[model samples]
Target: MERWLGLARSLVIYHNPATVRAWRRFYGQILRPGDLVIDVGAHVGTRTRAMRRAGARVVALEPQALFARYLRLTLPRDIVLIEAAAGGAETVARMAVSSRHPTVSSLQAAFVDAAPAAPGFGHVRWDRTEEVRMVTLDGLIARHGVPAYVKIDVEGFEIEVLSGLSRPVPMLSVEYLPGFASLTTRVIARLEELGPYRFNPVVGERSGFLWPDWRDGAAAREWLAGLPADAASGDLFARLP
Candidate 1:
């Protein structure tokens, strides 16, 4: 299933890393050799490959059965590409399939609700629907190993995904709904719940970096809380305190 979906949604921006060049740079410090990477939404394994190239043992996690198949084919044999979603437990959830853009398809309504009013809205046509297993970070760690870094881009359900984590991920990243700052607030709180976190955004592909000279975590959150909803379309990188 992972293979078919990757071929179907290769055009989606989420699977294409070209637009997030700056984000890759900002996360440079966290990517290193032998480090374990828990890619929560390992759709197509694009980021999974990146982490591998950057020298990390990636545990690519995806719930969509089709996507999981692709991860197996595309990723190196060493990558423990798992077929399931990351929440809090191993269960099944109804997933929404994209007829237009399969990569953006997600089971969580919050993710679809946070979709931007842009070109990719109808991309995932929702042609098919299915149920996929869901698991948690601690569970993955127990099965594979505790990760040095974890990346979550679960759309609007980012909070629920984060809420499911039972282990401390030293360095992590998650998507933010600029349109729904309330969601962003919850994400920040969740990050803080794990430990100290700082906000840094990258604008316009690889135009440049934007790291405000904030005094502390509070200051950084204050700055992020003020950015316009359309100010950016990226993830918030954080670290454990």
Candidate 2:
């Protein structure tokens, strides 16, 4: 019974109109017609729906068994929902999802380590562990098709997912937690290897701050490598070179 309640709480927390509108703009403005989209950490299909609404083919990859099931039920009939996580070549990994605040789920413990000192971290309680199936980017692309726009929000595992992609999809948006981003420095460096990545906080989520960029890929990597220890949410957009 408590599990059901927790699930319901997640649904309501995510289905806010402000978040919906922000995503609608992102998909409408960035995604193109006939574009294939890979949604890593699709959660309950909010972005999946927004992508479909923007006229794109979507592959919703989720690691949590229960969340994946919820996505299947919520996403459109046309979207392909995959019951696996996009990560390193392995086929499974342990995912830690918070019990009190399931929204702060992460693939790395560093999130929990950093959050205690962060604002609003006091209310979160991580009380669950689930080993889920894992899939790689190359495998997913070969199975469905190439994605032009890929949205990744895998908590701390975003770096692993990026590495699995053998080829650069046109545009990629990934959520980077500053606390974890330092730990995943390779991810910062690799995105730069793709050339000229731009980062901005999600519009409407906060006041939306646009960050500085490096003159070249190398500089960008260095800048990120030097980031402070504060944990904040930001999305990175890299146009493949």
Please tell me which predicted candidate would have the highest lDDT against the true structure: 2
The ten-residue window of minimal lDDT in model 2 covers 200-209
Best by the TM-score measure: 2
lDDT of each: 0.68, 0.71
TM-scores, all models, native as reference: 0.81, 0.83
Q: Write the per-residue lDDT of candidate 1 for residues 57-93, one digit (tens) a residue.
A: 8788887766677677767899887788877567888
Residue 129 CA error for candidate 1 (Å)? 2.2
Q: What does candidate 2's lDDT look like per residue over 85-193, in tens digits?
A: 8887857778777755666777767776677776556677778787888889889888888888888887767778877876767777777656555644566577766
